[model samples]
Target: MTQWTAEQPIVSIRDVHKSYGQVEVLRGISMDIMKGEVICIIGPSGSGKSTLIRCINALNDIQAGSIQVEGQEVHDAKLDKLALRRKVGMVFQQYNLFPHKTALQNVMMAPIKVLRENPAEVEARARALLKKVRLEGKENHYPGELSGGQQQRVAIARSLAMRPDVMLFDEVTAALDPETVKEVLVTIKDLAADGMTCILVTHEMGFAREVADHIYFTDRGVIVEHGAPAEFFTNAQDPRTRAFLDQVL
Candidate 1:
């Protein structure tokens, strides 16, 4: 088991409340994600798990409460949101690679344009990341040429290219075939093993049980239960958690 240290949390969400017009999606959601920790957010469909994760990275605007990432207030108008995005990498369920760009080009474009890094440096870093994800030979391949799992790996590689301090994964394996899910999960497992501070919103119960240091179970826009995986899964204090686990597990 990995020990939790006394280091300050890298991501802090304090009483966060978000709603889209009349529909309230998140209700006073507060959580602390420590540096080098992997947290899995699991819940039923339309339970606001994705909305909660998206709010942390400011992909969704919050009407109330605050979010702080790496000691910077996320909602601060003066703060560069784009720069903040680089620090908080997000991988979507869909592999959002550019159709016209090669795998290498898709990874390289962000650093070159957003960070204004040298093309040579960006390309080198992109290649190294692709290699890390075991796509060393597919750098020149287009997204269409790769399988679903391979494309997702490329998406993971693209997110890592920014050297993010925190990574957010939203149902990353929901779109993959059951056979292909393992490869993406393996990549994520490697990330967790490497101490990448991650917030994953997924339905893969087995994956969450194995990779998550901490797990939060959400329902109807609230975090119903949260604890170490062992406690959360085996000895849950909340009836809702137990019921949910029983149904899924």
Candidate 2:
């Protein structure tokens, strides 16, 4: 594990550009995310919020500029993409759990299979992670037997099994029932509270305002404004940002 200073950014994205067949999704996006910081990205649909995080993890390659995680260039051809993924764990909207596996098995699979870690150690960690997400006794339950929130929590535990340096959440609550969303959000909030560096792309305005260290508003593939929650929510400088907050908040 690499030690990072408070002054240094664990994740640095500089003027990144992404497009699909001339439909540009990200344009000159830049941000510096420090270790232990919780950054919430909010914007209208098609504003590139999800695309930007995807580019950070190299799931979508960029057309120009750079993204670095802990001084390692994310898009370097020689860079091991799997290694990068191990350091950056991502949870998406859908809980992509293996239907055949139990919650504990779902969490244990990646570390044991992908990292070739010892099964015993992986299982132990998986149990602890499940408990951390408040799914203490669901270890034996399959995905189909669990609620949406419970399955999502299992997905979070699965990501944590990799022991990532940073966690990326891309609308992890979007698919859940309104009642289930709070449980999922609470799991994420606990991760943030535990000093995990996180970058979240979400539409949950209130949750974002409460948990984020910095709030970034992106529009038309560009960051229109960003600031601490107190300032960003109360005194947005950009017209676009103000309009966005008015609608959401």
Candidate 3:
């Protein structure tokens, strides 16, 4: 395995901060994500795991510090937000597919509209991506007709259609039924195996242990601990990390 700790960063966050009204969320956080690294972040609800990643893709603006992706500043005033988004795909807990569109249509829209790719080519790639996520024949199925897991898979295919450099998954399996969670997890595992850079914020400790190259523990708006799966899971040093692990693991 490559030593990600020594590698140049694909996403670099420096002393980041975020807040809502009078309440502060992220507080002076810093981390560098290396290319082809699968990073999983775990924490209690309201610990700012989602917020941090949101800032990474500029979904939420930071109050202080900077986030750089592939040498481009994410929050720069003149930054081409749409262009940045094309390089960083994000999946949320809810399967936010367009109700009126078929699975394939959902996956094909961005590449066609935003990237202005040939419609025929986009359709072909969409079909392949849907199949990659194990949705071989469901291309014609609408979101409402599919199960939550299948819908989530379509969401993944949609993100993959953009051909992003980094993928951020925020509690993707959280809303799925117990049995369906496995299918989504399997899809993500396959992506990891295919060498996609993934940053996942999940409550699925087992899945994180299996798929994540680095595990991060966040608490009260700060990264409290981080380590390789073996080190973080077995020999955590921070009290907050140990206590949280005690509850989850």
Worst 10-residue lDDT window for candidate 2 reads: 1-10
Given candidate 2, what's the lDDT at residue 151? 92
Candidate 1 clashes between residue pairs 3 or more apart in a chain or in different chains: none
Q: Name the lDDT value of residue 126 in candidate 2.
A: 93
| lDDT by candidate, in order shown | 0.89, 0.93, 0.93
Across 1-249, the per-residue lDDT of candidate 3 in tens digits comes to 243342679898999989998889998888888888999999999999999998889989989999988878898999999989998999989989999999999999999999999999999999999989999999999999999999999999999999999999999999999999999999999999998999999999999998899999999899999989988899999998899989987
Question: Given candidate 3, what's the lDDT at residue 194?
Answer: 92
Worst 10 residues of 3 by lDDT: 1-10
Candidate 2 lDDT over residue span 1-249, tens digit each: 356566789999999988899798888999999999999999999999999998888888999999999888998899899989999999988988999999999999999999999999999999999999999999999999999999999999999999999999999999999999999999999999999999999999899889999999999899989999999998999989988888887
Candidate 3, number of clashes? 0
Worst 10 residues of 1 by lDDT: 1-10
Where does model 1 exceed 4 Å of error?
1-6
Of candidates 2 and 1, the better by lDDT: 2
TM-score for candidate 2: 0.96
Per-residue lDDT over 1-249 for candidate 1, one digit per residue giving the tens place of the 0 to 100 score: 133234767898888888888988888888999998999999888889999888878788898888888777887778788879988999999978888999999899888988899999888899989988888899999999999999999999988988898999999999999999999999988988888999999999999989899999999888999999988888998888889889999
